[model samples]
Target: MTITLHHLRYSRSTRIIWLLEELDIGYSIVEHHRDETTNRSQDDLFAIHPLGKAPAVDVDGRVMMESGAIIEYLIETHGAGKLGVAPGEAERSAYLEWMQFTEGTLAMPVLLTMLGPRFGGLDKLPLLQGFVGGEVTKLLDYVDAHLEGREFLLESGFTGADINMEYLLELINLTGMLDQRPNAKSYLERLMARDAYKRAIEIGGPLVKLPG
Candidate 1:
């Protein structure tokens, strides 16, 4: 299958690149840069999808958007049952839960945390920050607790669900939240150390590491 990935530096799209590497498939990358002043995606992305988002993948000329959807599709279509658990598998339910959890439950508050300070100074955004902080703490605490005594999200091993999760965890880490969550911290470090992840960094550029 032909895959063309529209990648944005330091964005969630990096997860897609990482998974493609883990799958060991041939794909091309169309790199996009954030605006210097606004730090938002460029207009070039609109040509790829209506949302004009990064990680808009063109597979066999059919465009796919949303990082989670793209990750799952690639796993099902090209992963050869490597990073994903097929139907009737032991951990399939858990796999699906974590996959949806990244975007469905976790992304909003993480995004608000990052974008809050930008709209207003930290001092002025106290109420907003307070609520967002609580939500982030609660969610990550659950993740960290789940990760205790486990290497990856699943009992089996590293899977596409972990790749789906890495982007948000990295952003949360930049917020200084991971410092108190030992299991999550170790988990992120382990993910970053993977050879496939290292190669993805080389291709997509490292995650920005700057707080939103």
Candidate 2:
């Protein structure tokens, strides 16, 4: 049976679609439209995910949710010796390290800062916003420094770790914060150069809104 990805357009789900393309796997895409009136995902889509979140998948006979978890599962199952390091390889530890760092250390702060305005406008909550911004900047700088002499996040080639990092880096760029680091800028360019990423964009490009 084909894998069925229930995804929302222009969201983090793009990473999953991109990873699948990178793996050269065939999967069916199920588009879920958000309801502007209810400000929720369509009812039918809600049934598949209680939180009504996107990037969920029906892999074979099993159901899964969350962008990170889905990518991990795909890499472990489909990537194996291809897009990731093998089990006993010395780089495997570092591979997992960057993966966790991307989500836990890097993304957490960036997301908190983004939510600052919604919770309480950054101006109204200066202290909280400052803390979050400080953390985000720290993580960005860490990544930039780490990439100074490196071509990829792990191993000698692009791996699932890079895929995960790409999503976070794109978000950083969107927030106009990536230009502060030259290494980050160069890394983003290399990621954009991948043929799989290019094809993934073509497949999912309609959903991507280019910045004016």
Number of the top TM-score candidate = 1
TM-score of each: 0.94, 0.88
Which 10-residue span in candidate 2 carries the lowest summed lDDT?
203-212
Residues 103-134, candidate 1, lDDT per residue (tens digit)? 99999998888777678754587887788889
The TM-score that candidate 1 achieves is 0.94
Error of 1 at 66 (Å): 1.1
Q: Per-residue lDDT for 58 in model 1? A: 98
Pick by lDDT: which candidate is best?
Answer: 1
Candidate 2 yields a Cα-based lDDT of: 0.78
Cα lDDT tens digits for candidate 2, 74-114: 88788857777767988988887887787778878876765
Distance from true location, Cα of 176 in model 2, Å? 2.3
